[model samples]
Target chain A: MKFMSNKTLKMSKVLLSAVLSVGIIASLSGCGSNESAKNSATPPADSAGSNLIVSQTNPIVIDKEAKTVKVYTEVNGKYFVEPTRHGVVFKDGSNGSKSVLKAWGNQNDFYNGLVDIGAKPGNNLKLDSVGVAVEGDPLDVSITWAGAGKEIPFGDGILDSTKKGFDFRFGGNQENAKAKNTGCILCLDSCPVGITSNAAHPTKDFDNKIAEFKGNQEVLPADGTPVVVTFKLK
Target chain B: MNTKQRKWLNVLGSGLLGFNFGFVAALLLAQWTWLELRVNTGLAILVGVGIGLGIGLLRTIKRPLAVESISLLAMLISLLGIGDAQISSLKILTGYTIREGLLMPDISLQVANLIFSLLTLGSILSAIVLKRKISG
Candidate 1:
């Protein structure tokens, strides 16, 4: 009986050790798999001027003749916008640009579904037209930031770009645009050009960091300070 | 130890092993699918029966009471594992920050858990009872 008990104890120890070994191996493999998955899904950052510049002090130029707004990104590099169809729109007069930035789906969906507007190789969003309004003086333009319900204003100032030699300029600091509490830096919506995401929906390659600069606080512009356009109002 | 106590120990060990295997399987499945495929009633039933049968065969316990008790414990543990795996999967698939995922409403998850729990219990009980009768 004593011998039989000893054998059973030995077997039990062997079984426990085997289970532990398998568990450890499984966990390690899981970590490895996750790391690979994350790496593969990360968006490429190799493009020239691959940084976003939020202009705090510069006014986004409105070209009424071209029916487009020249959105000045610090770097002409890649960028993305959400709700591909209606990326940038103007709030007609100061209702706070609220109607212009409606959520595409549930409000929560806005938090991570920012579409890439200009990050692909050879694919650049140099100029987007404002789809909602073609001609108007002092249009209230705004862009939707992820999850935030409020529109980031392009300052209370208004300019008519159609006027010959009417130098159109709007002002605000880049700090407000980059701040989590503040909305977008450039009110790209006032421009007559419409912007769209590269993809119909956000793919794994969509970089959340660009939308919500979580830990990285420094607002690094890819190019130099964004180009400032002087507009001659009609 | 007496034969009766040894049999109980065997049942306990088998149940623990079953739980571990089932948990691992559920976790792996969740990761592979990225939470798109949830642990539902059918999955729960499969995990419970597979674990119960594997334990019964491995332990070769003849006591009906021991078999039933172990099956119950194993099924419960497996359910917990499934729940945990699904939550983790949701966090990953939704792309939510860790804090957001954890705080998000889990009404659907709760409903799934209830269904899976019931299905697992029924399947495990049936497996244990059938095995006992066959052995007898």
Candidate 2:
């Protein structure tokens, strides 16, 4: 009996140390991941979407002061997401934002997976930072969003095999990305259907849309003609 | 130490941890989904019990637990907490857009709930329970 007990105790100690050592190593490795996989992403030498000064073309967008959804994320496979009852909250002084998944029915799993993927909260994404932009709402209310995946299918639930997509114009406004020119596109080639809003208060698009952009290309503007932008905000 | 005593310590400490984590996860999920019930309470209890028992198997443990064991638990809790917080936030933000009756980009809350409860937290919590049992 004594031998068994002593053996168990010794073995447990060794295993415990191994467990802790492994964790420390993992966290340390993550800190340096920001080292970047490629040369600093050159802002599209004119890849600027709107505001010219700041672009919302990237997967994630941030307003910094507003604590709201400038633009969110959508993976290709994810089908549905829940709505954010609280809306978005932003961390102050952040230069970037992560693409957010819409919190649908399975929020817990979605969230945990993200953290595993290194989604920074309180620093990058603050859930409790309820939209100060929206008044009379709970400050801590965490807003959940639904995820959209399949490419922009055409009306009647079929893929738009045509090159007709919307030519998006930037509200050109930097104050708040309120979508303007949401109507009337001069061209619609290889574009989806219409102008619609995405994670950003206004992910300019041709109407008849749903927010989905995983395993897909960046949403180009419609009309094949550059959507002239004019940054105007409140 | 007697095997029975080691077993009890492992089981009880791990059990408490499992219960506490489940409760916290539920709260966090609720916050993310903006729904009253992110994880069904009854279902959560069942999960918690199963986890507790599994950990209890590691119940024959060392005393006082160790630094490494505790650190691992902390890491898991921190990670899960952060994830839950994000999901809750997304739900709230998307709610407003949809309320305005606009179809927008959003991730599914149900999926988040499952991942958090069954996979992430569930795995770590179970692991910790066992760790504590063995350490004791």
Estimate, for each residue in A40-80, the C-alpha lDDT of model 1 and write its tens digit.
32212211232422232222333334333323222111111
Give the clash count for model 2: 98
| Candidate No. with top TM-score | 2
What DockQ score does model 2 reach against the true complex?
0.08
The per-model lDDT (C-alpha) reads 0.29, 0.29
Give one digit per residue, the lDDT tens place, for model 2 in A1-234. Answer: 979866755654675566445434443443233223212322221222433221223323222233322222222111112222111111111100111122111222222222332333212112132211111111111111111122232121112323232222211121121122111111111111111111221222212233222111123210011111111111
Worst 10 residues of 2 chain A by lDDT: A222-231
- List model 2's recovered fraction of native interface contacts, to 2 decimals: 0.08
- TM-scores for chain A, candidates in order? 0.20, 0.26
**Model 1 spans > 4 angstroms off:** A1-234, B1-27, B33-107
> TM-score of chain A for candidate 2?
0.26
